[model samples]
Target: MNDIRVDIDPALLTHHVERLGELGELPGGGMARLQYDSSWAEAQDLVATWMREAGLRVRRDAVGNVFGRLPGTDDSRTILTGSHIDTVPEGGKYDGALGVLAGLAALRALAARDERPQISLEVVSLCEEESSRFQANFFGSRAMLGLVGQEEPRTLKDADGVTMAEAMVAVGLDPAAVATAKRDDVAAFVELHIEQGKVLESAGVDVGVVEVITGLIWEQVVVTGRQDHAGGTPMDDRLDAVQAAAEITAEITRHVAGADGAGRVTFGRWDVRPGWPSIVPGEVVLSMDLRHTDPADLRKRATEAREIAAAVAARRGVEVTFERLKDETPTRMDPWLRQALADAAAVCGATSMGLPSGAGHDSQLMGEHVPAAMLFVPSVEGRSHCKEEFTRPEDCVRGATVLATALHRLAY
Candidate 1:
């Protein structure tokens, strides 16, 4: 039984969070620190400085994944912690920032006590996870795991037509050396993040021990039909792509609702070609985002979704094509690490419940190479990726303490 007490300073956490927020402050009280941007550069430098101030050895990988290392009695294996630092456009101040700040505070608390563990501890401020720029989510995590594809740098593009390669260089990183970023010394991983949903808050729980990360399926649907003059075509005679698309979208939503958590389906983005009041739409392209915690259920839902689309297209006399944009399997947390977090939460006098993460995270990628677990704090109103997102200071402090205690137990 280890007797390490966490000495986290609330003021230090708040100060660092405020200072980091200043780098990418938007006009409307939000943050916009996209990857490889100038604001991201400044924020990275600031966090690196804090890591140094905490008496840790700090360094960056080839893809700009910053790490702070606290050496232990034996440095052969390491316990890794922390989260991403990038923010979505018009995103809130506390999404990824909280996790990184908490890691810093926890490490600093342990250092103040002059405690050493059996294994080294590291805090990583992962470079890219939001995909706000290149549609390359988990870029830093994937690079660290050697999961990045060779074509990613040349193919992915931002709204400004900037390639990932270009963005990397703009931030003083080399695209060719991405493979060198993979590390095999990590023994375990823990990430502390906001719930980003109202579950924990509504349940009156102080912390959430994540059990699984939901799997996702993204599809691009295209429906083709004959275009005709609105006045010249009768209601029954016209083969309308827009009409077919609308029917398919409605059916998809309805099926998801009836699936009993089989999965979630969303038709969030749509584009209808040749917008004109007098002309019928000839083509419709839309994006479908679906997710499920159960792999079998996810497969069933995806199959049903495609079948529904095909049925609708056939009945409406339109040609439909479904192209998969992204597909990711669900990831389960390490059982031993989960128990460690549960024990730490009890020690901190915080009630915790096991929950599933509805949103994707870098932890999903890290889990591929190392044993990983995550801690989640409640989000106010279950809101995230928006300007209105917030987490109470007390909740933040409690979560950080739990993280510190857990890390201490694991390393010591």
Candidate 2:
């Protein structure tokens, strides 16, 4: 290991984060820079400028994944760091932004010393991870690994009916050149992000070295029942889709509660046809988001939940269907990388623990093709995907220092 001290300026990280936040400021006091949007374009430009200022070579791929390279003594392979920059709707400042900023800070700190690593260091602002605009997650990572299917650009659409291809072109990125985004030289990847859950904060831990990213099973459940006039039909005579959906939702929640150990189920979105007070709903479409660290448990829970939904629909005299939207298997972080992170945390005198990430990340996708690890800073109250999400600057600085130390060990 190199006898190097990891030093990062907290004010610099804060300044870069605040500047990125200005690009997509929401009235609700957070950010909303969805993929390929105008705000996303501007934010990418700002990051490009910062990378150039830091004496790194700045470049963007076809899908708009930005890379700032600090060349090393031997550039045979590169050590990749950073995270996605696109924000969720009403997302906090630190979620994805902090990872990118921290990567820059670490690289800049090394550059200031006129030091070069054995392997090149590249800080990436990945293009999409939240899927806020289109149903595309890990767009930038997939492009880097050549994992994106050819049909994806035409099939996915945003709320405004914009195809991903159109959005890419609108941002002056070539859609046809997506294949050029794949890289053969990334030796390893490390991402730093907010914990996005209350576990670290509740436990008073300064950092979390992730063991695994949870597997996710997203499904759309549709309950079909007969519509009846609210006034004319007796309660016993009506077969209500909304009631069946409610019962199934409650049952799913109960099942998840019984599973124990970081299992989660959310029925966040719903759509009811003929949404009028006078008419009973004939159809209800609700989304199910189930996650767990164990792949078998995740699949079992999904199957059981679907069966329960069926039983609930049968009891309510309704027909139900479960349409799976996306199913992602659990991914384990590299053990060596985890150890390096733990050692770095120890060096920084920061408390660290092994925790599973409850949320999805591009790291999971990147893990499919390369060795990937994630570092976590505390999220106050474990809240995320909302404006109320926050992580203290002290925690942020600690996380970044740990990241810097680990990157130094890997690259230098």
Candidate 3:
């Protein structure tokens, strides 16, 4: 076995995680550091301070994406790595933040290597990604890729009616200057993130080389039924929207379940109108999340799912509508970069496997505009998006060490 490794300062990395974890920590557990919020602002400033300490040029863009740059001798093009800084509501600590910290640690390690890279290297802390606060998912990455619409800032809103533009202004960012956030110099992007699934843990692998991000189909299914007094109407004479919606959702689950591991679906959000003790619900809406790795298969599955929903509603004497919320195609990682990451893992004495990411990530958007790849560390028990989510500290350090070695290989 041949191995050449790069070591990261564990103490320094642990300090970074611990200090930042405290900023948006909930009283009970987990984190909620949404973009442009006070906790988020504090965390961003703290990371920038650490970047300066690492001898990198630190700057926040128009939309609040923070970058720590180590300029190359040529300085014309750049290689970028890192993850978002924002967290999902009640999200675990490791998801996106680990990637940023790992990149920061890697850059710091490289800074001490006595030779600068041939191309500029940067570690980015993207501003908004989770969509936990606003409907503007991948806001930072989209801005960087020059994909943001002129009305996005003014139209995207949070639960509190706060427009993305208003939130930008609140953070001292001029929303009108968002166009300036676009960049054409990023040549390649790599993200190191927790797998957030059971793949690596079940396979007993140290890391995963992501093959592709799964394509997703999101829709709102609204079932309409006649409202009637629950106590006064005969059971056979009443049309219950909630009951019809429930049957449709159950059928969707069964359909995806029959696809084995090739497909998945979730009805995560629901609303029954005029919730009351004696009145049957007249309308119910269900938010549907669908996924598959193959584009054709995903489309076929989504179409079948819609048909199933309509059939279920018809059988229950109700009207249904399918409103598309999002439809994203699968993003394949750069093959060259995937191989590079695999080789880097071997160099660090860690086993690697090829896998697909089930969850959407900023890389899915970034890969559309630039060469992008991702690496995954194991998540304990496949837990994520909750307080119980965790990755072992040793695994964290090992993954970051592999990332540092990879950065050295690409940059040096």
Candidate 4:
């Protein structure tokens, strides 16, 4: 292990977390920092100010990805770090915020060094990853990878029926120039994030070196059935859309439950048209989220899920249609970067373990375009995505220190 150590300030890290957490805070506790919203815009501006305070050149991309760059003696390539800034509805503070702050602290410490690195380092506050406002998941990363379609901004709409292009204009971003956000200089990406699960906490490990991120499939299922009054339609003659949708979701759940603990499925969102209590529902829309680590297994399960839905719809005499919202293959972390992170944890006197991430992250998409790895700090009680989510100050600093150590090893 190298004898290099970066002095990560626990107080500073905690302070940043607390300050950022207050941006989109709700009346009860959690936040809703959706992309292009006012709260999100404020958070991005604050991060830019902090990046400037860290002595890094700051810039925002056409899609609103905020970057803080530290130049190197050899600036031909850059080592990228950080995470998304947007949050799921009612999300807790630490999920995506910690990674961006940790990267900021790491780069700040490295900037005070006497010697410069061969490669530049940048900390990015990715504009959107949670897809809370629109159906565009990984919008920031996709912009960098040049994967976002030209029509997306004009077509994708939010709950208020505002298009993504109008939202971009509201935030002073040019939807027409989104193609310019793509970069060819990033050589590697390292994101520091909370484990968001109990694997590390249960094993008493301080940090986790993520090996792979599970593949995911998002399907929007819409069921159509005859609308009839509850008094007029007999139970035997009624074609109930809600009944069919519920049955399909239940069957899909049972199938995943039997997949030996490696599969996951959730029917999280539901919408019923003509939602009167007495009405036999005319239409119902629901979301299906399926996940597995193996690509072929994921594909097989997705196909099975579709078949099950079809069978249920046919049996119930309701017409069903499915729209694929998102389909991402399993992504493996770069081997060398994973080892470097483990070694860095060892050097910092923190126990490390290799684990697969059950939750999807921006790294899953970033890994497909550049060499990418993730460092995970333990989340208390494995809680995440809720108001109770938390990580200790020491563990937060330890993870940041390890991130700094790894960057030193890779860039220096």
Candidate 5:
């Protein structure tokens, strides 16, 4: 296992990346291949074609997860690799796409070897992770883990008021059979991705072995107040919901910022009812996204956030309520698998280090069900989730080689 190594073609990786990056490119700038959209479907079909060219059998599950399989001598259990295929609205090219490409490249290299593995190897292009089009985050991984709610397909709607079920049907997928996507044969899983931060690049490292993934809490805060004409309502008499909401968000941000830089809070979305300059807003709806590496600290911050909102609302004479949209605890990677990835990096002559992932991923959900781990390459200038996001080509090839080497150790 220590001696295991696999060569990845740099040109092949570059070519696939350029082709995939072109699918959902937006007119203004970045890409947006939202889940089940036309561009997303086209990208999946292209990946399936690449899988077939790489000498693997390809199939799509009921939830639209595309898998490419290389059968082994003993096929009862499988080793799974790859990541989600979906991207955020106007998202960069490498975020989710690179992991899928790395897995494909790894499988391609392994296929040319003389000896077959003792367990099946499979790569998946998960249907959704960004939740850019719908609010169902990790929908693909949840289906595989048997965590998706039965009514989600009919209930979850996109920005355009289209239900997930309708979108699935449009893509020729039967939402009624979502349960069929569950799999119990996966023995282990590994995902290779870009760091999406400056951790590795700042340290001048070649790759990163993810030690843990941060916990996240998403809450929707809604404030209600009296509506009146902006000109007639006195500043002191007006119970402005937007003002209260803004204060609440500002207080939360201050608290998180004052703490060690490890904790993060964001008010990414907000809406003011009767959005007019001449109207005193009667209702305000805002999103609070909180994250921390420590589970206890994460919970503490969430509690503090709620308390702060309630206090501010009381003082401001407005009614505030919170709805918990999502809550995910911190996830630790499998130690043995982390060591394996580090060893693989060493074998591939790439420097490696351990770090925690601040962003959410399909791996966080998958790790709870299987022995899972992640490998991360550098993102130049720590830029991600935007058009300026980039990773050097050599770093990309090195990461793929490390992934292939790790797969060789586990599968063979």
Candidate 6:
């Protein structure tokens, strides 16, 4: 393996991570940098300030996706890198933040080069990816690709009941200008992110070269049963919604538990009506997420889940209805770009192997329009979306260095 050094500042990157973590930091731990919220605005502004400090031309698109551009000799095409700025509520600092900061460091290092690249390089801090505020998936990337529906901004609301359009206006952005963010010149996209899984750490690898992002099926199940007083109704006589919902959840879990490694399922949200000690709930809502790398297998799992839900509801004396909140097809990284990432890792003296991403990323959506690839640094213990999520500083710099190496080959 050829040892190549790319100028990446470990201390600065770690410092930036600490600083950004403080923006939406909670009382106990983790961050809450939701999209279009004040914390998100503060975080984006801070990143913009840093971009300016790096001497790049900084601009915020209509949807609030911040871009720092280093123009190339041939400005017609651009090479894109970076990740989302938003996070899940009380999410770990490294999940999305590392990708954005790594891109910034990579671009800054590349800017100091003596020769210019053939294509421009841009680091994007996407406005939303976690969907913490609205149900709109990949808002920033969708906007960039002109895939957002016209009515989304005016229609979607947050927990505060404020429309997305209002939130945009609050941040001094015009929702009407969203169409203007559609980009056609981005030739390639390379995002640097934490693995958020145990693959790299367990295998004693430094970086993960993502091959495919899993397909997902999101189903919201609402179960209805007879409500009865806990004290008045006997256990055998009660047709409780909670019991039915619980049984349904358990059975669904059982269905996927013994299955092969090709599929996985999780029920994250459970809302019980009349949430009181004495009430036997009449309604229950559950959020089900089914994922797999193969499209056919993913669909089969989804169908099997539906059948299981129906069977469970029938047996439990409950009426169940399902609503699909989101359905995403599997996304593959560009083959050549994937090879470049692997070669870059070897050049950077970091061990890396191609792996499938269990969690979805902006790269999954970005792949639709541009040649997209991703580099993953290890998440300590594979913990993510929580305060315990972390990556060693040295590994962080190593991932960024690899990204820089890849960018040098792609752009320069």
TM for every model, in the order presented, reads 0.95, 0.98, 0.97, 0.97, 0.98, 0.98
Sliding window of 10 residues with minimal summed lDDT for model 2: 1-10
Estimate the overall C-alpha local distance difference test score of candidate 5: 0.93
Q: Deviation in angstroms for 174 in model 6?
A: 0.7
lDDT per residue, candidate 3, 318-338, as tens digits?
999999978888999999889
Model 6 whole-model lDDT (C-alpha atoms): 0.90
**Alpha carbon lDDT at 78, candidate 5:** 96
lDDT of 6 by residue, 8-39 (tens): 87888889999998988899998898988899
> Which runs of model 5 end up more than 4 angstroms from their true locations?
none
lDDT of residue 205 for candidate 3: 97
lDDT measured at residue 206 in model 2 versus the true structure, 0 to 100: 86
lDDT of 4 by residue, 1-412 (tens): 4669777777888899999999999999888899999999999999999999989999999999999998988788999999999999988999889999999999999997888988999999999998889999899999999999988899999999999999999999999999999998999999999999999999999999999999999999999998999998899998999999999999989998997588889999999989999999999999999999999999999999989989998998989998999999999999999999998888889999999998899999999989999999999999998889999989999999999999999998
RMSD of 4: 1.3
What lDDT score is found at residue 336 in candidate 4?
A: 96
lDDT of 2 by residue, 86-120 (tens): 99888888888899999999898887776678899
Candidate 5 C-alpha RMSD relative to the actual structure = 1.1
User: What's the distance in Å from true for residue 210, model 6?
Assistant: 0.4
Colliding pairs, model 6: none
Regions of model 6 farther than 4 Å from truth: 1-4
The candidate 4 region of ten consecutive residues with least summed lDDT is 1-10
Off by over 4 Å in 3: 1-4
Clash pairs detected, candidate 1: none
